[model samples]
Target: MLYVLVKTKKGTLVGNYSSDKAGCILGRSSSSLVPMAGRKVADEHAHLEERTDGLYVIDGGHRAGTLVNNVRVKEYGPINKDDVIAISDYRLQFRFVRIGNNEEDSFSKRASILPVKSVEEPSPVNNEKMTRWREKIRRSLVSYMDLRRVNVADMDDDALRIFTAEAIDRIIQDHEDIDSEIDKDELARQVLAEAVGLGPLEPLLADDDISEVMVNARDEIFYEKAGRLNKSEVTFTDDAAVISAIERIVSPLGRRIDESSPMVDARLKDGSRVNAVIPPLALKGPNITIRKFMKERLTADHLIKFGSLNKSMVSFLELAVAQRKNILISGGTGSGKTTLLNVLSNFIPDNERIVTVEDAAELKLYQPNLVALEARPPNQEGKGAVHIRDLVKNCLRMRPDRIVVGECRGGEALDMLQAMNTGHEGSLTTVHANTPRDCISRLEVLVLMSGMDLPVQAIREQISSAIDLIVQQSRFSCGTRKVTSITEVNGLEGGIIQLSEIYRYSQRGYDKEGRVRGDFGATGNIPDFVEELRSRHIEVDMNLFGGAQESEAIQDGF
Candidate 1:
């Protein structure tokens, strides 16, 4: 017997085919399957079956062509794994393999012999009624609860009693009937506290402008909006409630956190990053942090509009990308390093194959020829985990034109540098560092983490040769993230890597609104790539490099 597995979006089904049916079988007419003759079979309810290990025919005679996501299968060939078989408009995936001798008997007994049925359809009228009922209940509950009276800051005994009574009334309104014998007031208070979100917390989470949510235990909850961190009037009744909330947030994602695992890093359906740590790991009680990505990705044009870069900086970076310069973006945490990397990646031509490796899949590149790879955490048994170092080494064999490392925090930096030095030009990566000099030292330390005993000078030499540019970003006190410096490495001299400041941000005090005002301009030193740009017939604007006073005004905004 041949073990055959069928998969749909809902779930997977396993079965076996006998030798008599030519290893082919018919599913519901709604399924995605095609006949060997490359024609639609006319009989909608024909019960054609498959034989063991032999090709069988599919009778797909329907209005919709038998195609897998639109590709028409024209032959009765062996089905490969992940091959979508389309019988009509409905689709199914097929995987066929040999059944082991020891498991053949059990597999035959477990094979599903019944014909597949069409998917059940729900009644639209019933669904509409349910939605209306839910809306009505929500409105009634909201009205019965006194949101204005419940103050999270100072809830004395008298205030608690009044709040609890109001909560009970709201709960009674939500339900058709309630048991009088139960402690309805206590239960109501608990439910109301959760639903009303009695403070600024719920509004903060609902606000699309907020990018991050942070809770420092049960007493304080902070949120970041428009890159500025603001304290919310949210508080948990106790540490237990905070832990419970964390559990609920991670539970839907098939993640877990308890005494056995007091910490978890997870993501929500909306691509928001979440991190939670309970007691022992977190001394101040359970804490949760959420970083939300924008609904629309940040584009290069958006960066320019935000005064992150001037025309010269943009043009120079674009040319550097086209010329296959390996660039490194250095910055402290939350300095928009990944954001800058994403914008720079847009300069890459769409025709070249690009591979992106990251701890989390955060970078959103627009190129068509892109392969995104994310690192996986270890399973419960601590097995089957794939690290960034593993992915960095694997990418070298993937025949990529450019390899982008989202951010290098570990030994993966060594592998990434090796890939850059070998043949992967135009590769881009980000590192956590306070300054350009510190970035080199960080690289040396990370390379040592790879278990290679190479001299520090050797690592520095590799970095100077492999990296063409280092772009440093900074987050100001006003929460404005900007590119502070763009330095070009010009090889090493006397055991020190030589770097020239191509573009520097000169702090010119602050504006009337107290926002940072700085001028981003060249330091009068032309880049080594100037000759290369001239060779390509690209004109140089010396005035943009601060040769003229009018040019300073033009570059001040960026």
Candidate 2:
């Protein structure tokens, strides 16, 4: 049997393999036997294959190639016992013991050779001492706060971090005689993290693969990566640590969460959406959910790469936007609704002025003339609340070339429809629903919520005339998000809005690895907007709407 022992910042990692097998690849790929999902590791970085004589290591042509015993290897080489390999920032020690040899004896012999801790779990006494050290660091921080006469509200982040580091150093000096097993750098990091960052969430948030971070309580944390939820080993020290982290998030934005008002929605500086619920309303201690925002603005090419939409779909959507069709993107929560809306909005002409309204202000439009408006929650006295409806109504008077409401969750849907009906032709918005037909019904319900006291038929007529297209975005159980349907609004018939599906996603069942297996195909229905597009001299290739091969050959001819 052969195995590799790697030392990470988190802990010691032990990956074992049988020498009789072919080989075990090592990289950040999910299929790799030992997946190193760190920022420094490449996608399919390196491989280890077993041969006739002995095991061999082959460099996977990584830009940052693998290292053996402090020297970079140019090609394949034989693996020897007690050899150290370095990949990215990680250092791994190799061990090869015959299958019949005593495993326990080999582990003890090898463990002593490395500076890192053994792969075995930490003792309870060590855990207890670490907890005590964390408390001493917190107490020292409090003492420093009092001695320096520092106000948390007034101090800048750099100043606060300096004080925190000094306090942690002092605590380390005071406890030097107690134990030397504690990683002082890590302890200081934890103290600073608890003070300024989101505590245990800092590392999870830094991981690019993790899309969602959920903190059920102080000690229980889970994160969603690649559309699957997994329990995270990271956790807060106590309930107080969780509460302190929540306060750090909402305090800067003037949002409050407590027994009086225990729920708030805030966003990080990088535009990641955050929702926190504490005590009273929340049965769990302190529940926090964070949806990470992508730093790069995704365009049509990116969506096509993700299989969210094909080139034909992109061409049709681009033409629809250029033809000034009002688009309503409908989907359930976390279904990539806003992302699709942003991509479609990019199809609009750069010369036009765009006004965007949102509760959290997440849209990143590249147009120069963009008027971004955000809603405000009322204060403790229940005053000064600016809602989506108010912003929608006011944006009309701003002479916007197009009005884009982030998501119509309330009465704002009425004002958005009216604006689209009057002069705003290329307006865009999103709604919560499962299908395109359900989106019209949802809009009717939202219009009724406007307190207009209008007839149901009147609202139906308004919706049918205003919305030209409904792009239904859906997030599958496997965590892949795609545009499930693109339906054209053919106006109201028999007092009900009529819809025709132009493109639909056909699911072929889940793949072996559990990823979504589907195809985006046209419904063979020629859209009514084709004539309008031709009238405006917008050259939309007809071959794009054809079958698979036809569409693929000239999908770039838009």
Candidate 3:
């Protein structure tokens, strides 16, 4: 990887950046990758470009000019890493570092921190020039505090931010030139955000409409809003800066990521999911994908309003959950499985003790009697790893009235099936699958992953008897997620599990506005346990699922 170390006139290392990206624009403007505040630097001074011949420094046609090794040049080398490229008062050195190779570590790399730790810190951020000044001012504040023997560890967040802001003002006034183009107020704000808050992500997280934030590179970003993806105007200073942010996130949770471990799964204070990739694994430079959590907990009514499901499905799920029926939710990534699970979980009576197992705890259950368990990855020493299967096994010992495994991705499926069959009737979990039939096959594969050499027929029988319902969630071309199918596991027939769909979503086509035009219809196949529900004195409107019925209250025209 190509690296750049930015130094001051006094030779203080300020910013460390590295990327194999084609080029970098350096100037006084915020758009420049290495922005300088000095008056001698033009707004668009110079840039570094990697060519077929080699890396070269090209002048940006400014009279201030680009210099390399103390000589004025309109253009410079296929530059060596040892070369020093200078513009204005700052010194820049390029270097290349090699990283270790290990493509097979992807699965273990995504391990999540046990018992997720989240700290609620808030601040604003932006790309490039602001990124540089944020670093400089942040360094200045730390130095000022250190030189004066200030112990900031004991100070509260508000106190520290206030103190840091004052020190930043003093540093700029005493150090930076008066004619420099840097905006002091903006500098102070960015520094404060980086030092005390999430920097750049604060605004994105605060926007309720945005569901996700993607960091592709230092100066490029994207976000999902209104079920559509769009480019974001925000960015970071460089790859190193992005790495720093990733460290800040994983470190607080007692998790570590380095050359040995290059990826991680974490959660924000609001329970938003976080995944970061760096170096050899990420060719585009450091990458971060954040799935933002909702501020308000969603209920069945919300799903109905959003055209995800209708009253009949909600009513059936409520009865099933209350009756202690094991349910397995299936969906592709980000298809609202968790959200639907969260809503369905609420159906359990408050009197029952519920235990939830997850990789990173995202469910927000309001029941007074509830225990949530998050999975743990091995530490730096490669020991004490707690997988989802272990959590499921432990939950069985807790005497939980209801067990909810967040997702059955591995051997946990076997343990979950056993728990469901062995009197943990109301257990719930999810898996990645496209259809109800695929869900059965997925469960069989997950069961085999348990390391037991059980016969295929036995595994099929175990699944058929344990899981009562399979709710398939799907994300459409228009980005709307809906319940595509809700099928009941009737029984094992000729070594195959029989599935009868009680409800399904049929999309005729897309509308003029490109929104999916679909309707949730009843397939007229009632659950095999419906008679048992009636015998137990539970009431259900059987006619609701008698035939093709669309939810009349949908506002999205589904």
Candidate 4:
């Protein structure tokens, strides 16, 4: 059922509207299906079209702009439930509630994984005297800056930190009521973090060992190191302080988060992915999760050292990429799919033109002839939005020898496969799947998601011809991620796509320390394409095939 919630400046009203065969019009005019009342609303502001695949909103070419989730959009659809629609002076929660009756699959039918939560860890510096001293220093710092009419935003970063640190020092020394036993330097750092940085998160962000930071609430902060979760001993002064830190992270990006848009996805200047959730949905408080990007670029040798794969696997991947064989990296979340994709990307020779497309620019490709395109979120006015599918389609015209997509999450899967089949061969991408067989099924599902009316057999044929290899990277329960298997997309026969496993990881068992005990071995089954294209100057070490005759005979009659 489709539900429409009407919100005015005075209050909110719960109501329902009947859907017409053509579509529903949301505007101020009485004739509009959902007659919005406001001066900013146009007579026919936007049209909502419900297709078999999903619901889409098309702008009526109005200058005010049509919006979804506070994002001004010209034409966007498949708007999932729980999404807020903003028009002129009105806000509406548009939803299609399907409560477990799976008569048909829809947005609400998909399962969701909630953010990780941990218990609050008390700060070691959170003493009564120290808290008071820090609060005093913060107040004094604000007064000093205001008296001098200092514009923190305009000041150079280096100059600002130095100036703030010195001012904090002066505030501490001028006040004798403050405890001397308190580490003055640490106190100053805390004050500075509160004043100019991400409050308590500054230290975690600065630590080289920390990979992920989670803020469940003002007092609950957790971090990840070497795949182990540990609660941090620091926190924001309050919920408001937590919101302030979020603003600081997003302000430079010209992004805003508030009641209308309580959820946001962003990245730090260093490319670390950051996500924030605020009130209404986030009951506890403002929460932030930051996944730090690799500071040092990793190479294939690094993967070898990390045991993500062996020398033979890396050699085959390097050759596969160089030979213009389209490769897909498959894994679950946090399974190091992106890391492996990044390492394998450098395998592309510097001489070729490379195009990288992503939702947020993360791939740090060093190729001189590289064109990076990042998908853009809708502007505040709901305009100027670009999606991964559009980027994948447009990059084809850019004459790139290799197309590196950061990840394929939607209809873009169809376009990516088409690109690989149409001569842009050495393209690389990552997909969310548990195993190589599941990877094939996942691709089929994603391709069908494109809303193309093609038959299943046709899609299977496209997959078999388009993709050459699949590298299955997995994160074991032991908090370690490594390549579990590498398979070949041999061909499609009957109605099934045939797969041959080239390399596989055999896990004997977990060691005494709980670390995964596994070794990588080669599957004797070789790719038919390798044998057919032997004359193409691409060399494959035949000896590597003697280790194991890996049968991905798992899902193929094709």
TM match of model 1 to true structure:
0.63
lDDT of each: 0.65, 0.76, 0.77, 0.77
Q: Which tens-of-lDDT digit does each residue in 1-558 have in candidate 4?
A: 554555442232212333323367877666776655445678888887877777778888888887888788898878766677777656665555444534534322221100011122334755445566777788788899999999877765534654676677778778877665776756775777787778778667756567789999987999987668888766677788789899989878767888877887788978888999999889999999998876667788777766677777888888788888999999998888888888889999999999999887778889899999988777777788788999999999999999999999999999999999999999999999999989999999999999998898999999999999999989877668888899998888778888888899887676566667766788777777678667676566777667843322111000
Task: Estimate, for each residue in 289-336, the C-alpha lDDT of model 1 and write its tens digit.
Answer: 877666557776666666666667777788789889999999998788
Considering summed lDDT, which 10 consecutive residues are worst modelled in model 3? 110-119
Which 10 successive residues of model 4 have the least lDDT summed? Answer: 109-118
Give the poorly placed runs of model 2, Cα more than 4 Å off.
Answer: 1-132, 151-154, 177-181, 535-537, 549-558
The local distance difference test score of model 3 is 0.77
**Which runs in model 3 stand beyond 4 Å of their true positions?**
1-129, 172-184, 551-558
Residue pairs with backbone atoms closer than 3 Å in model 4 (clashes): 72-381, 72-382, 72-383, 73-382, 492-558, 493-558, 496-558, 523-548, 524-548
After superposition, which runs of candidate 1 have C-alpha atoms over 4 Å from their true positions?
Answer: 1-202, 226-228, 236-255, 536-558
Query: Per-residue CA lDDT of candidate 3, range 299-354, in tens?
Result: 89888888888888888888889888899999999898888899999989999999
Candidate 2: residue 503 lDDT (0-100): 89
Best by TM-score: 2
